[model samples]
Target: MRQLVTVSCVLLLAVSGFAQEDSSQPRPFVEIAEQDVKPSVQAIAPIDDTNVFFLNKRGQAGVAKFSPGLSLIGWELYSKVKLNSLNSLGMGPNYSLVTASPIEITQAFDTAGDGSLDFFQGLVRDWQGRDNGVRITAGPVADSNGRLLFALSPFSIEEGQPPLARLVAWHPDSEGLQTVTESQLLISSFSVGPDSLLAARLSMPAYTEGYYISLTGLPSFLADSPDAVPDPLPKTLPSLLIPAELTGGKEPTQMCFFGENNQTKLVLTCPESNQLIEIVPEKSGSQWQGAILLRSQTPSSIESVVEMNSGLLLGGGPDGFFPLEIPAEAFRIESVNIAKDGIVLNFSEEVDRFQGVKPDSYTVKAVSLRGDNKTLMVEPVIESDGKTVILKTSEIGKGVVLRVVCQNLPSADGDALFNKTVFYTIHES
Candidate 1:
C-alpha cells in the first residue's frame, strides 16, 4: 500500500545587516582566522539563516550561529563520524542536519527524540549489506514531502553485470526504504522539481557524453514494501535527454532546483568543464534548452555552487571564496573622461590584476587624418580601487580617433572580460 506524505512549509526571514558595503572587498588571499576551526573545512551546509554547519575531511562536524553583525554568536562541535567522505548535507525540520556519508545517511536533530537522538546513529547497515563498492554520491535530498531520496552506484563493476544506478527513497512515515527507479546508465546527481518531478544526470562509462532525464509520476513509485523494485522501467515515465554539447562535454557533478512554480529551472555544476549550466523551459513551455551561464579559468575549478538571494556563492579548488552576481553580463565601461594629463577609464566593477593593469596587455592605436592606424606608446596606471585605470599619452589632436584593445582581462571573481575594444573620438580642444 502507498503511504501519503505531507509536505511542510516554513517561513524564513531574510538575513539583514549582512550585505557587504562597496568600500569593503573580499580578501584576495585565504586566511585562517581565529574563529575558524583548526582543521580545514571540506563542506558547508546552512541549517538556517543564522546557523551554519561545517564538516571536515576527517568527518568532524561543527555548528556555528552568526549574529546580525556576522559575528560568531556561538560555536560547538556537533558530531564525529567513522566515515572519511561526507558526500552532501541537507536541512530538515527543526534544525536537523541530514548528512550523507559514503555508506549511510544520518540526520541529527537539535531536539532529542526519546533521549536516543543524542546517541542515535540513524545508520541503516543492512541497506547495502557489506557491499563496500556500493556508494551514494549525489544526494539525500529532503524533499518538501518529508522523504529523503538519493542516488546510488557501484564503484567496482563486474563483467556481464550491468552498472546499476538506483534512486532510493526513505519515508519517515512508513519507516520504509525502497528503490524508486533503476537504470543501466550512471546517475550522478538528482533533484526534485515542480509537480514532484525527478530530474537526474545520467552518464555512461568511458563516454564523454551525458544527459539529463526528467522522470514523471514519482508519487506512484513510493512504496511501503522494502523489497519493492519496479520492473523493466515504467513506460509512462517521461524522460528527456539534454544535449551533450549543452553540458560542455562533461557530466554534471551537482544539481539543484531553483525558482518558483512555472518558472523553476535546473542548475547544474560541471566540474571537469568548470561551468555552471542551466536548463529552462522554452518560450512555448513545452521543450527545454540548456545554456552555459558561468565558466572558470585554468587555475580555478568550481567544486560547489549554491544560489543564495540574488547571487551564487562559489567555492572550489581555488583558495578563494566569493559571490558571483547572477545574470552574468559583460563588465561595461562606466565612464571615460579626457583629463589634462591622461585619459581615465572606469569600469562597472573591480578588475583583477591578471594582465589587465599592464600596458603591454593593451594596444593603443591612433587614427591619423589619412585614416591610418598607428600604435601609440602609452603608460597605464591602475587605480588603488582596481576598477579605474589611466592611460598617459601624447597630446591629442583634432579628429583623432583612438582605439584601445584590451586582452585577457579578468574580474575579481575570475570572470573574463567580454568586450575587447573601446573606441574614443577626440573633438577639437
Candidate 2:
C-alpha cells in the first residue's frame, strides 16, 4: 500500500490594539477562509485507497489503478459491456452505493473479508419501459473491510403515467447482485455520508411534492446473509422547496436554495425575479432552508438577479442586487399593455417616511421622454411600502424602455449616493 500526506499554511500581519482607526471604513468584514484542496485521480468508481474504476462517456466500461500520488499503474476495460447505466462510484460503512441514476437501480457492494472486485452488475430486466433502453447508473458510496456499497437508480419516461424508480444493492465478493428493499421514490439528486445516505426526490408531476432522505442499512443482508454488518440509523433530508407553504404565503414563501451543510449548497432561482430570504438550518440534519421571491425587473424576459448557494450573487450590479424596499400604499390603473409609461421616479423607500432613506431602496424609470410619454401615466400601486407602481398606457407601440434606479443600498453605501438606472423594454410579441 502507498501513503501520501499534504498540508498548506497561510500568514497575515496585524497591528496592536491601539492602532489608529481609518474613518474611510467603519464596519469590519470577516475574511472567509477555505482549506487547501487535495489532489488525486478522478475515477468513475473510486474505492478505498486501492481500487478506482474509470468510465468512458463514449460508452465503455473499465477500471484503472494508480499509486497514492495518482500515477496510473494498471487498468482493465470491458469494451464489450454495453453501458445501460452511469453514475459516480462511492463507499459506505458496511455496504457502498454502486451505479446510481435517476432510476431506482442500485446494488449493495459487499465481499466476504476478501479484497477483490467481484459481483454482478445490478440489473432489473423490466426496470426500463419497453420503448426506453435498459441503462443502470451506479456510483460509489463507502468501503468497509474489502467491500463497498453502491447507490443505484434507473431512468425512463412514459406518457399518461409517472415514471417508475427503485433502489438496489450489489456485492463484490462471491455473491453477485442482490435486490434491497426500497421505498417507491422519485430521486433527482443524492449524496452519501460517513454513516447516512442523503437523497432528494420529487413526487409525480415533478413540482407537486418534494422530499429528502437519509438512510442506512446493514452490511450483510439479514434476509440473505446474516453474518454481515448490522443496519445503521436512517435520516431523511428535507426538500429545498416546500410548495404547499410557498404557495400559501409562508414566512419563507419560496425556496431559493437547499443543500448539504459545509460541503455544498444549491440555489433554486434568480434574485431579481425572486427574493433572497436568509438561509436557515433544516431538521433533516443534512441541509439548509432558503426562501425566495418571484418579481422580475427587466421586460419580464431579462433576468435581474441569480440566486445561488455559494460563491456570490450574480448580475446584481458591482455591489449586487437592486433595491427591494418600496412604498406600501395601493393605487389602481386602467390597462396592462402599453408603450413608454413615462418617467416614474421610484425610490427604494416610501416617499413620505420619516426614518430617512433605508439601506435597501432602489428605483427604475422610463427610457425616453418622447414616443409614448403623453399617452402614459405613472402612479404608485403600493405607495406606503414602496414595493411596486402602476403605469397606464393608452396604446401598445413598438416597445417600451424603462429605467431602474437604486438608493441607500447597504452594499453601495460609501461609493455612490445617487441612484443608478437600468433599461428594460416591453413588447407585444
Candidate 3:
C-alpha cells in the first residue's frame, strides 16, 4: 500500500506540470480551421468585425466568416469568373457579388444564350455597334438602394484617340439589365450623396486638371419602356463645380460623402499635392454654389476612400490600409512683411523645427532692374511663440526685388510646406 501511494503522488505531480506548461504557451495571432483555404489576398472588404470578403489576383473570390476569437466559422469560394482584369469588389444586397472587370458588366446569367453557364466571352461594342472589342477601365460601387453604380472609361488601343467616359447605373428588370445616366465627364471617383444625388470627380487625358461636379434634383425611373431609348439627362438640374484655385492646380482623385441626410458634406482627396479638401453647399446662394471648408495634409496617396462606422479607411498604400481621423488644422504661412530689422514671416500655426527652418534652407535672391540675380546670405531666428520667423540680412534694402525660396519645411507632424516661393518688392519705408 505504501508503494502504491508514493506512485500515485508522483503521477499527480507530473500531470500538474504538464497542465502548467500547456497554459503558459501563447495563442496564435488568428485561428483558422483546417479546411480553410489560403489565397493570395490583394484586397479585403470587411462585411463586419467577424465577416470579410476577399479577392485574389487570379480572379478567385471567397467569403470568410469568423467567430469572436477570429476562429474560422465558415469559408466559401465562389465559382471562378474569367476576367481580363479585375479592379474592385463590392457586395450588394442578398450576398450578390459585384465586381469591376474588363469583361462586359452583366448579371449572373447564361450570357452565351446556350442554356448553360460557361464563362467564355464578354460583350464588346465596336464602332459598328457589333460585339468585337474595346478596352475599358471601370470601378463598381454599391449604394444603399441595392443598385450598382459604375464609373466607366472606354478607350481604344489605337494611338492618339481618347474615348469619352461616363457614369452608369445598373438595375435589375424583368426584360433585362437596365442602364441609365447621361454624364459625359471622365469620372475618376464618385459617391452617392443625400437623396441619392451623385457627386463625382471629373478629369481626363485632354485636361489632366480635375474638379468636382454635383448633380441635384435628379429624376427617378421606375421601369422605363424597353423599346424606347433612355432620355438624355436634363440640363436644368443644378450642377456645381468647385473652383480650380482652391484645388491648388492639382487633380482630385477620389471622394466620399460624410454625415447623414441634410447635414451631408463632400470630402475630396487630391493625390498630386497630398491634400484633403472639404466642400459644403452655401446657405444663401444658387444651388450650384459651394463653400470650401478645409484643406489638410494626408500622409499617403489614397486610391479608395470609404466611410465606415468607426471612421474613414484609406487604401492603396504599401500597408494596404490606413485609418484617417479628422486631422488637426494644418500650419500655413499667413503673411510676409519687411520689418525695420529683418523680414517677418507669420504662420497660421506653430512651426516645427526641421532642416527646413535653418537659414541655409532658404535661397534669398535680390533681383536688379537689369535682370541680375544675386544670392543674399541671412540668419533665421524663431520667435518665442513659434509662429514667427525673422530673417536678418544686409542684402534687403530699398528698390530691391526680394525673392525668398523656402523648401522642405515640415510641421511638427512632418507635413511639408505647400507654397515654396514668396516674392516682394522692398520699398523705402
Q: Residue 221 CA error for candidate 1 (Å)? A: 8.2
Q: Per-residue alpha-carbon lDDT of model 3 for 1-429, expressed as tens digits?
A: 000001222244346542222222333222234453444443445577566655555655555555544445655544366444444566653333556655354323222333222332221211211133332344566665555566555432244644435444444431222333434555655667666666665554464333546544334554453223345443322244444444667766667766623356677766565566665543223243333433455666554445553334333322233445543464665456667777777666666766546887777787653457788887888888877888788667554546676665666566666545554444332
For residues 211-241, write the lDDT of model 2, one tens digit per residue. Answer: 2322323234343452333344232223343
Q: What is the TM-score of each predicted model, taking all chains together?
A: 0.53, 0.32, 0.50
Scored by lDDT, the top model is: 1
Clashes of 2: 84
Model 2 ranges with Cα > 4 A deviation: 1-43, 46-54, 61-82, 90-166, 172-181, 202-205, 208-238, 242-429
lDDT of 1: 0.53
Residues 260-290, candidate 1: write the lDDT tens digits. 2335666666667666555543221332322
Q: Which candidate has the top score in TM-score?
A: 1
lDDT (Cα atoms) of all candidates against the true structure: 0.53, 0.31, 0.50
In model 1, which range of ten residues has the least summed lDDT?
4-13
Better of 2 and 3 by TM-score: 3
Q: Model 3, stretches more than 4 Å misplaced?
A: 1-46, 49-87, 106-137, 151-166, 177-179, 208-212, 223-232, 235-250, 260-262, 271-273, 281-287, 293-295, 310-316, 328-429
